[model samples]
Target: MMRLSVATLSGLPGDIDRPRYDRAGIGTGVVHLGIGAFHRAHQAVFFEHALNAGDLRWGVTGASLRSPAVHEALAPQDGLYSVVTRDGAAERVQVVGAVRDVLVAPRDPAALVARLAARDTHIVTLTVTEKGYASSAADSAAGYLAAALAERRSTGVDPFTAISCDNLSDNGGRLKQAVLAAARQSDPALADWIEHQVAFPSSMVDRIVPATDEDDIARLAGRIGVEDRAMVKTEPFRQWVIEDRFSGPRPDLAAAGVQLTADVAPWEEAKLRLLNGSHSAIAYLGGLAGIDFVHEVIALPAARAFVAALMDETAATLTPPPGLDVPAYRAALLARFANPALQHRTRQIAMDGSQKLPQRLLAPIIARLDRGLAAPALTLAVAAWMAWTGGRNDLGAAHAVEDPLASVVADALGKATAPEDRVAALLSLSQIFPVRLAGDQSFRQALIDDLALLQEQGARAAFARFTGR
Candidate 1:
């Protein structure tokens, strides 16, 4: 069995697709943080298209902030990997060669900083998730950016655009805040320079890249007759929308199906509230009912109806971008969620609910309240999350709940055994909930009633009642 690398690419079966561009001629102009499955399936794939179109300056160098696992996987292969887009039994396989190198931040922080400082590296992108942003203490991503910008500043190098592909609203603004805060801690002068010169452009990325498992690897290997440990599996659908503002040169990504817009806020809000909001609902409620995969949950009558209702309520709170069809978008999302081949896990999406809920569910809920409307479906989704954070499901089975605020959730659950008291305790955490909504009696009672129903009956019954299915 030959290892999948540039050296082995020629020996690969001619039936498989390889990079169309000259891999040797490509330069590493982009440094991406958190080169996980999602990045490989989304951003890396986009750059591969750009490279194939003769844009040699956009080759990416991926850097890992915490785990060396991704570096270990790709470095051995010379930064080559395959992406399999599955649509039912159909699979489209392409070997992506856009990633020129990968580095572990802990092993060689100076090298990482030097890469960011390099004149060739004009764009810095990140896929670090919502919790990756630092609200209090500095995070690794911010710290690295601060150091890199300091070096670039001292050396008189031009600043690069910082693009955040996270699901958070106004992600660019949020990331800028984190980087500036981190830079300010070391040198306020450097922070001031960064604030004026650098550009943090918010972007929205959509793709269903599930966590690759042994089965996916084996299937891919069977198709290509090679062992590539860094293979990523995703759905056929993909979308990227970036803000047009940039501090320095950037690739013509518009030719690569990327929507370059002056305003990404509308797209971000719709995606966060509708697609992400329903995803959280499926995770908490569906996982509580012992459902494993997203498709399985969406297949259920009650779950499907609940999600549809939830999206409808969320859409009411949003103003769709011009020329966008809200109903079609909703339909497409449901179909995407029901992608049987993807096997997106409920538990995987359920992680980091404490950080995720404020944007995905809470924002829309607050919007409805501001308009003096009751959001029962969104309220039920929150109640399901409360039950999920209780550490046991409706089946009386215990599962480990992974969240940044897991300890706080545990403490909240421990503080009260009653449904009303539990809802009160969780809502009292002003960080997660807005004061107006949390203080609303009707909203609180909606959560309390649903929580009681979920406790007495199972998730299915409660969902059925909530949706009147």
Candidate 2:
């Protein structure tokens, strides 16, 4: 079977959409990091729209910080890949040509730095997940930006706009700090210049791109009559919200259905609290109840209602962006979660609880407290997470808590056998909890009560009480 490339595109089904622009005339103006499935399905597709709109300078070159698999697969096919948008009943297949090249940073760090330093590369985007920014090694995203920005500074070149498309509060601000720290490790003067020149824009990217396995590969091959190694599967619904800040010229992404806003803070808060907070609820509670996938969790009446109630609790804390219908957004999130075709694993979202919970749950909990309200559902979600870290399900099957702080969590858990003691021990971890909140009697008691209910009655009973089932 012919691999998906510029050459095999001519033989695709007439209904299938291929790039309308000439690939040969396109230049790489955007350098992307963490070229995972999310980047391919979301930002790369948006850039394809920019290219199709006749702006040939926005073609992308994706660089992987560590993984060579993406580079190996895409580079062999002229950096071409396919994105299939599933809407439950049917699929929309399209070949994305926005990515003109691929690079592996570890293979040749100089190559990636050179690409970032290129004159026409006015933009740099990333989908390296939340934990990617926390890595301090020189091979990480922050390290690469520090290196490239230093080179650009030395050579009298303008710095590129660095956009973080990860889900976190003040995502841009966090990335800027990380890059600055990395730069200061070697050159403080260079870090100072980068602080004033570069623009680290926060962006909220919404799309469900599941990890494509061989089954997906074969299914897409049957549809497109080609064997593409880098095919990404996503839902028809896609959204990108970017902060309106840039060091140089950027593509007309607003025309590509992107929301370029002056303040991404409100939008980020809404997503983190509502959508992501509910997701964590489903993952911990559902994963503990012996559920495997997200749709399966939503299919359970108790689980579904619990998730909705959790979102409702968090929604009370957000001041959403204008024109965003809160009720409708919550409904859409539930609908998206219930899509069975996507095969989104609950365990996948359950990873990095220590890293994720502060943004997703704790923020809203604090907000609700300030409003003189209780976060019953959100507090229970945290309890479910504590139970999940015990590494076994209600069915007595082994469950893995895939977190960087797993051993620390275990040590905390091991410090006590009683529910209240366990709650107190975990709360004392300065990494996940703030000093004020961790020491508060009301908050600690709430966690103790919730944890007692879950550990004693199991997942169903606790969920039943939350849902009034």
Candidate 3:
């Protein structure tokens, strides 16, 4: 075994074509809050490409709020890593050098805060997932942003742009509200400062970065002939849409094919409602059918029809974003999800249902219902969720569901005393659904009916009934 530096590991023959750039000579200009796989495969790769071309003031400092394993692994190598993109026939490995440091939140909050408040740190980006936003119990991003903004105010620092890569509508505005609330909690003056100084940029990020397994590690090592600790693998396709809202200096991401626009609302809505919504549909419905992987679900006739139908329903409610070809976009999404090489797991997608359901299922359901249309596919997905979380699958596999509201959901399901009561208790959850949605008698009944079908029949059979196949 050869001792390898991060730079050496990244420059192998089959990997990134060049040696890692001398990043120590440049200043750290970006602090990425969540150093997850998607961020590494998508944003970090983009930043690395930009830096390779010319821009040096856009290096990233990886920060994790909870996980210390990443920090420990990358720190030994001076924050250098590799990204491997895989489709069915080809694999490309690139050494990403943009991250200059890795910071664990609790280990050194003071240091993290100092870096955030630093004058040279022009951008603070997050891929902290929807749950990390510390949004209220009622599904809002305002709470987390408020806390971060309060830290900024108490420290009296120059403002940097906060970019959210989470899949949400008006992600930037939601973050701003949270920051302001936190500032207001600290002092009225702090909130006033935030209103004047801060900028929150909404973004839509798309990439199917699956969890790495032993086979992936071996494949990467054999290809590159080096042990790259930070290697991540994902589906070949990727997309990022961002609002051009920045108060300070930022990278020229446009050079790397990133779309920068005045408003990201339309793009966000399209991606969230179509791509993410369909993903949830497949995950829940597929998981309950005993399918283990996303590709497997896509291969199933019922699962495929469910996703396609859901997308069709979603498309009816959404107008294409400016300059986007709706049919072409939908075609690409279908192709991406059906890529067998990705092997994204159902259990992985199935996590955080409480945080995901409202945006991915309920919103579209409500929108369709408002239009006097029935969203049967969406309703079935919701029913699958309730059934999936009700503790046992058809295989009798026990589910240790994860969510802040898991206990409550479990308790409510337990009291199922009856199907109607179960649906009522679940829907009436103000934390997961708006009052208007909870109070909808028709919607409640639909949920009750679908849930009953899911309980009586299996997932595949229930899906068939919902789709009338």
Candidate 4:
């Protein structure tokens, strides 16, 4: 019956796991973009642990770029929320007080710029997904970041680290490129200063944080005896591998189970290719099969073997990170994907197929082609995406496909329904497929065969054909 807030922290039940430090005493040192479920479950929880260990300066000021929804949800609660980590029947509930305030960018862009320029704000992190990095400086997160950094420069304040927790290869470099490119449009001088001064550190973050629904909120409220509309339910496993590069002081994140390294490429590539690649395969193929959840897909014998083969093909293309056991790491990932309590939906991952395929699936396919090897599993995954993108599932049910390139996909489908024609039409999309892959006869033939098989045999049978099981 009670609402969660800093004032109510002390009045909660004695058994409730609430903030150890005084919420009012903590200062905001990090400004995080995209106040979504993933950030709440992963990064904010880590900051809560650091705060619990007596670090008061690492509190986060959450910012949302598009709407006022997150700001509206958390402001009344003083940025208080519950994070429940679920692994099968076991669960741990904790109230996180790491976020002190929430800022909606459109409502007050100047406030966000001021927060970024603040002297105490040493880290500006983002989980805005890949599409947030717009190519132009006119309307993007990079544009806003550029404007804020320009303000800091004009005021003679130092630059902070720009950490990207997005799942992209060489994401730090990409962030730097986006930021510098945007800054160049306004002031070449400011761009130069940011390039020379600020640190754009790439990071690899892994956590299965599902989109919370009314059921999740009600379940948390029932357990904690307080209403927490901003609750996040996630899997127990978490990993954060960050490049050890920063312009200003940062919290000892290593104490919170973060891996600080000189090079984050291997880790980033591994997670992208191994975890993300197979995830896409499961999403597209499983959705085509009318499977609702990732755990259900991974539980299938054919699906499990298909994912393993996909990972094996991708692994051949990667150089493992130092001290990492590739085999053991992969086995652990399979176990994590099979966690039914996480309830990671296939439809959730199936969205944004056009934007995601380039990095997650296509890159590994390109690598295999370069090595003069046939990546049938990867090709089948690509075919599955093409079929799914046609705007209907195997059950003939029409679901909303939420890709930025929805028009492009529709155009591709309109051109032809024949296997070869459809495969050619989709492959010619230079945005998603590389020029070399598009031109390769063998790759094109392989994709056409797989696509035809998917159409004729259905998703499960096509998957069994690829796995030869």
Clashes of each: 0, 0, 4, 0
List of clashing residue pairs for candidate 2: none
lDDT of 2 at 29: 94
lDDT of 1: 0.89
Poorly placed runs, candidate 3 (over 4 Å): 1-4, 18-20, 135-157, 466-469
Candidate ranking under lDDT, highest first, comes to 1, 2, 4, 3
lDDT of 1 by residue, 65-179 (tens): 8899998899889999999888888888889999998889888888898898898998999988998996423338888888889898998889999999999999999999999
Q: For every model shown, what is its TM-score relative to the native structure?
A: 0.97, 0.96, 0.93, 0.97
lDDT (0 to 1) per candidate: 0.89, 0.89, 0.77, 0.88
Residue 201 lDDT in candidate 4: 89
Q: What is the C-alpha RMSD of each candidate to the true structure, in Å?
A: 1.4, 1.6, 2.9, 1.3
The digit string of per-residue lDDT tens for model 2 on 1-469 reads 8888877889888999989999999999999999999999999999999999999999999998888999889987888889988767778888899998889888899999999998999999998888888864688899999999988998899999999999888999999999999999999998899889899999887887777889999999998899999999888899889999999998898899999999999888888888888988998988888888888999988888888888888888888899789999999999999888888888889999998999999988988888888888899999899889888888889978899899999988885768888898899899999876797788889999988888787888888975763
Q: Which pairs of residues have clashing backbones in candidate 1?
A: none
- lDDT-superior candidate, 3 or 4: 4
How many clashing residue pairs, candidate 2? 0
Whose lDDT is higher: candidate 2's or candidate 3's? 2
- Report the lDDT tens digits of candidate 4 across residue range 1-469: 6788877777776767888998779888899998898999998888888899998999999999888888888888889998888898988888899999898888888888889889888899898888877564544789878988988889888888999988888889999999999998989998899889999988999998988888888887887777888888898889999999899888889999999999999998888999999999999999999999999999988899899889889999999988789999899999999998888899999888887888889998899889899898999999999898877888888888889988987886686889999998888788788898999999999989999988887899877864653
Error of 1 at 451 (Å): 0.5
Residue 366 C-alpha lDDT in model 2: 84
